[model samples]
Target: MAPSSDAAADGEPSGDVMTYHLKAEHELRIEVDFDRQVTVKLLSGDAEIFGCELPKGGAKTLSGVKCAIFTWHAAQIQIVGKPDACYEAEASAAMRSYLNLHTALEERRKAAVTTTSPTTKGPRVLVVGNTDAGKSTVCKILCSYACRADAMHGGVAAAAGHDHWVPVFVDLDVGQNSVTPPGTICAVPVDAPVDPVDGWPGEAPLVYYFGHASPGENAAHYKALVESMARVLAQRETDDVLARAAGLVVNTMGWTDGLGYDLLLHAISALSIDIVAVIDHDKLTAQLKAHVGSQGGDVQVVKLPKSGGVVTRDTNFRKRARDRMIRSYFYGSRSELNPCASAIDASSFKVFRVGGGARAPNTALPLGATSRMDPLRVAPLPMTRDLERCVLGVLHGDNAALGDADVLSKPCAGIVCVTEVDASRGKVHILQPSPGSLPSKLLLSGTMRWND
Candidate 1:
């Protein structure tokens, strides 16, 4: 496709549209800028964005995203607007590798379905990689493939005596979470392919607030959330045979050194991971293999090459993405959401922060004493100006009976943002998803804040 030389005063697309014919096993990689929008439509043949099949003749608008339109067979696509970067590649080893891994996992799923024993459950895969190594993409592709009945049954109809797989997608990346807002980890069952425009389904995600983007801020708190999530998923799989056979696809944050690496290992054990997919990192791969050997587990550590089209996002870009996630929660992605803002007395709900207290230096302590603060302690947050623009996690439990330990493990119902705090009237204004009172009065605070 050649660049158009059309005249448009506002820099929008005029009449010149471009079309590209992708060969078999090829992909069209595109990167759109944050400020601009691009429209893409499939003209002919089968093509998919991420793993969701593109609807023929329907124009899908994309902005501030870097994605690929892949086709197992040949495909023809049309573009109406210019992207920051666009190109078609004839070969993509990363996509091939992802498909192969999906195939092996499918075999495990089939075997799990044949047995009622929990020991023969399907593969629980944990994907670990550096930032921008396409870990999220890998997870999405795997989950999408798992939900594709045609792919599983070799082009046969799913109604032909076969049930669809509902594999669980666990997102541990707090900084840029695809399942839920930032500063939290969540899991959702994927019964269908994820939308290319809208990432994951939002029906009933199990979310835990970590209060900060990076796990390094409170590594203990993060690990506790992981353990809680694993426990809940284990119970869920135990009760549901299909979900157990479908298993899980876990995505981890891109901090793979020292404490970060230790957290990864802890997650593997906590989640009962069967396959550890290391994306484009040899040292991490080897280290994981060695650790698995020492632990005497059946964890298969496979190293996969990172896609060349994976874009490296800077700090500012990541911050903007996080803000978008927050904004999207209250105000939908296309401004389709109308959140209700209400003013309630400050005393109506209790806001608590997890982990942060005065800590004396270890050097200043007695010979055998440790001055470390309890990182899991939950303390009440004072209502003040600091609460302004802060995002609060609405916990799911009895407000009066919730203990500190419950705060650490309880799944959040939803999130609310503090719009205004009136100390004079002892009132606080908050914006929530629906037009009703909060599900619970126990709110959890973290470092996440939204301007709007």
Candidate 2:
């Protein structure tokens, strides 16, 4: 839903919304003109018809109809010849640029209130996401004078040092809107809490929404939540009373093959410019190889980490990341079943099973995919593949949260999910795609207890 009840459609020229990464794919063009008709000439075995031609005081659209002016909308751009071509291309490209710019602007505007103030030479990091993706741990470990996050969750949210601020939340699951308070985890110091008194938010980091919900879940509600949060954080960056931090460290919600790859991509695009992915060595190397840029024949790709810190009023980044950690620990996963230990990061991307008789890797199959895994079950998708497409609804049922997420491995447009389960212990850990051959079907039943 729109951030405001009064807000109209998302800022884009509406008719059909086609989400494609033009930057990574193709350049669009268009043309228009005021001229007369010459004749209809079909060339190349009548394969390519240049134009139908128009009358002197008339115009022609990209579709080849003659008129003073005409508007054509299609993924394949219209190329008119000569003067008209220049004008059409200019107008079409200009319009699309404005359209995308407007969409980005409007999205930010709706969520502007939630952005936190900035820090010094880096972004005001706001830690968000589901449990165990290292949201709080990362914030606690973040050095640099300007780096801070309000990561503590739960009651009496008081961190000891510069990173003592707490995370805030809005009820976005349907009608829930009450502010989330700190919980048990925030009170217990898994490690020494960052002392907030040591460093005050010199300038608060701007606030931004961080979430772990898969796409098509409650993500859209973030627009409204962000707006609300921005209002409180946009204040002076240094004000310390529950102030927000500058950077947002979004810990993903992954447990036993959840946090689908598509979800990760969406999060990277939405929350972080730099995706510090902790995939296994092979996958990372493959991505590095796939860096198809013209800069000296690829591999110069950079996610572009923010050079300088941000400035905003949200100063309690550490505490917030901590709080989110607590919430996610308690509410997001099958804590009873798996009993998560600690979060993982680049350092611990691989999980080792101590004593189950190990089976060898499955190299007999190929790690290929398709856009649709099972067309019969999947919703009718448009011809194009849009990663942003998601399954809607809270993943609250007794069934596995990953039922839909498994679609990632489909060839044409799939997520690339990697499930890790300790069948011996009836435990599971959904992970990002690790390097290897074809996947071994994680037998959740027959080997694992179906119900808790």
Candidate 3:
């Protein structure tokens, strides 16, 4: 309510720091506002003060003024006047608080819709290849480029040519993770990638392991791998890591058979992802197409460089064919959805995170809220010439075998696949399209095998 006499008592308080810098042709105007008489003073790296004071009012700052405040601190702006002479003290504090709050709110708003500025560093690119395909050589080239570019430009271009840049390097390749092998770049595993710059360890990405599964040897380990992969991907997706991935490189083991194909399909299905790019393996590409066709998805094929596909194998010339396949995996249109703008140089085995793998309600089971093991049973279609084709396929496919399955209404096209509980009891299941509602013309029935 009342003014503080102490604050106004001094024209310039002791122990307060201030500084002033003067450039050529600049005027430093310091206004001395006081209810009482006071003197003006400017102290710092040599600054001249010119101004006059009309005695009745106070000393007015004069001409030939040289005042420029660039970036100098510890200087002084002092006022000598009677106690309680400057303007109300409370008003100044209120202005300071308002400005601070306004600035903070503005910053928060900017964060919502900001794109990466190019002045920031670019992401670190790590390239890895299978042993024979010159994995080390690729690393060498990357390092050569990264080091030279960083040296010349001061650092990896932090300028977010797009989004962000992390200045970190880590390695975790089971047993082969080493960038210091002298010729090729070493692999880094999640357990021990590069150390964190500020306060965290390197983050591990899911290895998109694109190789063919080992055959005839579906040992316990294979199952374990599947479970482990599922669990890992689940954790990452839940934690939002999958959402942040830029691009993934999938390295397949040099084989393309049922095991590899199945494993690859299961993995993709598990992630429910549309592949972005293809590596230079023709065998893998064909398998990929088969799976995509089944799922009604589209993908671009990128073949590897033909010139680089030369490698020594079975016969000198035949090995050439193998080399071409390897290069082809690297060929394809850009993965339309690489979270990162750049293609990840690592194999795909590491990037695919487990996504929502929940299966839809079984269409053949007449979905219910309770038990899910029952089969959807509908009566055999009444002999109608138009429905003969549909009836034939179902009968062969075990649609007519069910005593309880009564044809409910208009005969549908074809039953897709079926599941069985007991193999010895001759139990079969028939799958149907996920129709929205039961067709009025057919009486849909469901059957469950009660082996007990």
lDDT leader: 1
Q: Write the per-residue lDDT of candidate 2 for residues 380-413, one digit (tens) a residue.
A: 2221112121111111113223332332111111
Q: Residue-wise lDDT of candidate 3 within 177-266, one digit each (tens)?
A: 222110011112221112111111212332212111132132122223334444544453344321112212222233335554554455
Among the numbered candidates, top TM-score falls to 1
- List TM-score per model, in order: 0.94, 0.23, 0.27
The lDDT, on a scale of 0 to 1, for candidate 1 is 0.87
Sorting all predicted structures by TM-score, with the top scorer first, yields 1, 3, 2
lDDT of the structure predicted as candidate 2 = 0.25
- Per-residue CA lDDT of model 1 for 283-351, tens digit only, reads 999999999999897999999989877889999999999998898898998889899999978988899
Q: Candidate 2's error at 158, in angstroms?
A: 21
Candidate 2 C-alpha error for residue 160, in Å: 19
Candidate 2 least-lDDT 10 residues? 443-452
lDDT, residue 382, candidate 2: 23
CA lDDT of each candidate? 0.87, 0.25, 0.27
